[model samples]
Target: MLLFDFMFSETLNASLVQSSLVCLATFSAIIWWLRPSRSRSLPPGPRGWPILGYLPNIKFSEWCNGYQTHDVMCKLAEKYGAVFGLKIGSKDVLVLNDYESIKEAFHHTNMNDRPENAMIKNIDNLGTGILFSCGDKWKEIRKFTITKLKSFGIGKRSFAENITIEAECLNSEIAKIQGNPFYSRPLLEPATLNVISSILLGQRFSYDDEELHFILDNLHRNGKVVGSGGALLFVPSLQIFLKDKIKEYRHNLDVVLKYFRGIVSKHQEEFDPYIEKDYIDAYISEMRHNKDKGKQSYLDVSNLVMTLGNLFAAGSFTTSETLSWAILYLTKHPEIQKRAQEEIDNVLNQNQPRLEDKPSLPYTWAVVLETMRLATVGPLGVTHAVADDTRMFGCEIPKGTMIMPNLWNVHHDPALWSEPNEFKPERFLNENGQVEEPPQLIPFGTGRRSCPGEQLGKMELFIFITHLLQKFNFKEAEGESPLTLEGSLGLTWSPTPYHVCAHSRE
Candidate 1:
């Protein structure tokens, strides 16, 4: 009995000693970390918890099947000054809220380099497309896309012809509604998808096609999850622990990838140098020629497929949502809607409006600009990471710090935008009938990684809005009064599903 007690005592002492030693070592390391390295200049923000840093202060809720970190991050920036530091897991992220700091970091500083983070590098298939890529690969792809876009009738007669066909199809479909209150999802989403599909894939799917429906459904889910701040932004570490959400993300990507792979494979099997139909065919043909000559090429099948998916998602969703908002805005404010219709009628004159016609339709363009500003689809713009330890706005930002540019703040700031919340299109036009310049208008973002799809997106928006206004007079659906302005948070902040009446113009 005495010997057993002695053994127990020894074991207890050993455990206690080990625990004390561990505590001491942790304390010393923390002290060293707190000392602030001479080379490091992290931006100032609210102090965080022990070990947790500022994690608790970060609002992370999984209420709607995903995290709401972006909303939380914005609120934090409001509380703390624009450029603040946040410790998310082991990494430190700097939040740049106001225009001044974002301008300095993104523009004046012009450090448009890919962040050195594992997550970015981890996206397997999408290796250096026009988006989320850096250095040589990005430069080459971006330049190639710019040249290809111009060649592919992006701002030319062919593109306008394609848009006109899609717009007419959309008009016919909306006409079938017979002025009844109906959900915009069916008409708006499919029409926008068809426009982009025609542009990128060189084909359009019938509204009833089963395969297209599957593709749209998968894409919608992927966008929803990524757009949700929690899944992608807040608890990325905790994401591994959540098996179901992770599975969904992978499954969603896989399904989309399968469709993309099919496209790439078919393009490969039916390659003809003499005959190239669209962007995909051209890209595949170029890639094959490069490969044949023993040259290293960046636009491999995988990258091409992923880029298509990215383009489809961005192009389809943003344009559709913006048009939806245009309809909603018109319904809510009929005066503005009437003015837009008048402008379109006068400018178009029974002819399909081309991209060049934007100059003539100043008021219509202003409404589009204002809608972009007010809605700001990708609200918290894609998260940017610092490539190196840097100082900005008198703060010491460490390397691999995730950056959240609260574009919402920049867009809605009373100082920059007069009568910020009001849906005023006149703010976008000057007396001479030109797009009034605002150097800080960063809807497409700035720096090296700005959206390459800006021109295409603008064209889509212009055509869709013009066509819709010309054909229909939108009105609020019964019981859906006081149309909800709230957007579901995710990679893109989309308006909550609401029905509106597309009263056909007699």
Candidate 2:
């Protein structure tokens, strides 16, 4: 016991010494690197510790409670203007706060790649998927995703029909609640997942499917956990100590991977190689057709699994969470809900809401837009990296610098909006009663790396919200606390747990 204790103590002490030395080296490098170099033209921002950087100023509890990382950047931007930098650990992240700066920088080839994170590297399929990849691999997969998704008719009537079918299932599931207060998270999650799953897996799960619900529940639970724990992704030394947290994240994604793998294996056994039925079959068909090209081709079994699953996982959470926020906001301010419903009534008038009705139902669409801006899901909208050394806003952005577009800042900047903090849908409507999409209202982002799933997400959000509002009036359930705008920031900005009483408008 004494020998074991001695060895353990020695190991612990050595780790501490290593950490301390790293700290010292980090500071020494910063001090030497920042020593009045006229050639260095980095942006103006906060000065952090040697290795620790600005992480000391970021409070995890703040993000957990309501304040998000993007919100932190916004406050810092108040002092540092729209284009500023934050040294996080050993990395320098250039934060773009305004629409103009972000728009300008995002399209620059030198500023349009993705960052490498230990956390994502560990979760990603050998860093082979779209969300955290770079170079030719990223280009190939991205082009493939865009082309395949479009070929599958992403924004067509058949696609809307898929979403509409899910809406019918969602309504039936909500009706099962029998007008009692229900947690809308579970009810809404499946509807969104089902639509995306159909494209990726060629099938959808029933609402009661245990594995389906497990993926959904963990997505909500782990998005916040992984997002909160994301600091460790940048801070390497701390990651080893936080093994359990990393493992949990791995395990959550593995569950999703496991589900996808099973589906792939089933398809593999039945893969006809010549026929393409869905996204999976299409890829498999391509792989079989291109086997002679060998490694020259990016098509493979692993990419097939991770790419499709990543697409599936990415689609489910944020869209559903945004809808949840919309419900919460509309319920908290019944006046907004009433106005939205009246618009629906005026246009559809008991007829089922259709995508064609979108133009006519400007108020309802405006309310949804307001929710996305106020809630600001995926605030940072994934970290970007510079493709090459570039200059922006009169500052030098070297190659490999992390670029973060603070969409939350753009949405909430007082100078950009009439009342940034207020939830007013009228801000989106013009004197002509047509919905005006503000240039600054960039929820989906822009440029080559912008979200490819934007159109599909918008379709699902519109169909789901219009249908739900048309059928039911959402109110705070009895014995529940008043709905709060305070949300938990995970993969997306999500509302804290709240229940709603659904009254059938019929």
Candidate 3:
């Protein structure tokens, strides 16, 4: 009886211990399941559904409701702070909303690379272009392109002469309109396209050319599609639903490339190594040199075609759109326009504005700066990628994470600019009546990957605006509804379609 009692007690103890172990494991698992899965060091963000992640949440933002992606991002920034994270589809995206964060993030060497997307990959097969390429390829092509652009007088007085010629052509085109209210884009786009064309192809097409019209039409359509189809970059699976848009975008791109390829072929047939007539000639010369040396080279015909496309697409549309926005703003605010014209008249004294006169025309320069700030073209400048595992704003950013610099938010931040929505050129002016460019006003962006055409763009704006204001007065069309200050977002943010009467100042 004693031995039986001992065995029974031992069995009971073993059974209780087994039950306790199972209960402990079950409790621990429940706790683990309930806890946040994100690491404490990661940037705080809204929880997302499995697989789909914050993609659905972003779609619900103003972007899907006919507003801009930058607007949606700004609203999210207000809720989640300046630096926020969102798991967009399978990608980790970190949006930097404030100027400091943007500056810091962009200045980092590891943050200089662009994120890969299905759209970019499809458009640039070998990824040889300067805009969307990465690593040594980007470095090499960009350096070579810059050197060639400078050699070709991109930001020099000689280039300003080319811009002046274009400006005169534009004025002549406007003069032919005879102060009639007309759509500005039709006139403005061809003018800007010609300026870039003069450098790239050593030629310019007349505004009436069918080829010019074809190129402009396709490019405009592509810009709209790029902005609308941005979601495909995040959720590539969305392509199934947006196949039509994808198809259209690709078609437009192919049309532009085909046109450029024909131009490049002509340049090749007429190639002169001794005297480089244009960027194409310079590139062809370098390509032949590389072939002669038998060195591996990125300077192939494919890269040249894509590079030319990048230059044209980037160089033409942005300046023209900004000028359009400036016209709209001036038309809406005639008083400001009058002041700017008065400044131009006082500075130039019936002479056409020149690049050398920029300092003398501070108010005019301020107007250009103010227009850029308010317009915020290229709102989300370009998506950057984290090249390696990094920590930013006290949070861990993993390798391959995408970075979005919210330039719109930075330009419109109420704390930085009083009445940020108001178009006040005086904001860029100081008590000394000089243009004061704040560091926060980074319209062309900052850092190594900033717009290469920045100086050229600024020169164009200065020369074009000064020349236009000097010659004509922009005013709203009679019988038309009041133009909205609100802009439609595309590859660039541009004013809604509005007609303006370029009443000749003469």
In terms of lDDT, the poorest run of 10 residues in model 3 is: 1-10
- What does candidate 2's lDDT look like per residue over 1-506, in tens digits? 00000001122367775886687677768685564321235688876655556664565325454455666787888998888886766667788888998899888777767666566564444435776667787888888888888887788887788888899889888877888998998888888988888888788899899877777776655564456555555446446545667777677767776777888888989988666778888877777767855547776777777786567657888798899999999889999999999989888989987787899999999998998898888787777888788867787678877777888888988887878889999998889989999888888887878888999989999999999989888888988777777876666777998889888888
TM value for model 2: 0.89
State model 3's lDDT: 0.80
- Give the TM-score of each candidate: 0.84, 0.89, 0.89
1 or 3: which has the higher lDDT? Answer: 3
lDDT values of the candidates? 0.69, 0.76, 0.80
Ranking by lDDT: 3, 2, 1
User: Which portions of model 1 show Cα errors greater than 4 Å?
Assistant: 1-40, 48-74, 108-110, 113-128, 229-236, 394-396, 432-434
Q: Write the per-residue lDDT of candidate 3 for residues 20-131, one digit (tens) a residue.
A: 5477457646664574433344588666533344554555654357545677788888999998886655566787899999999888888988767566465444444777
* Candidate 1 displacement at residue 285 in angstroms: 2.2
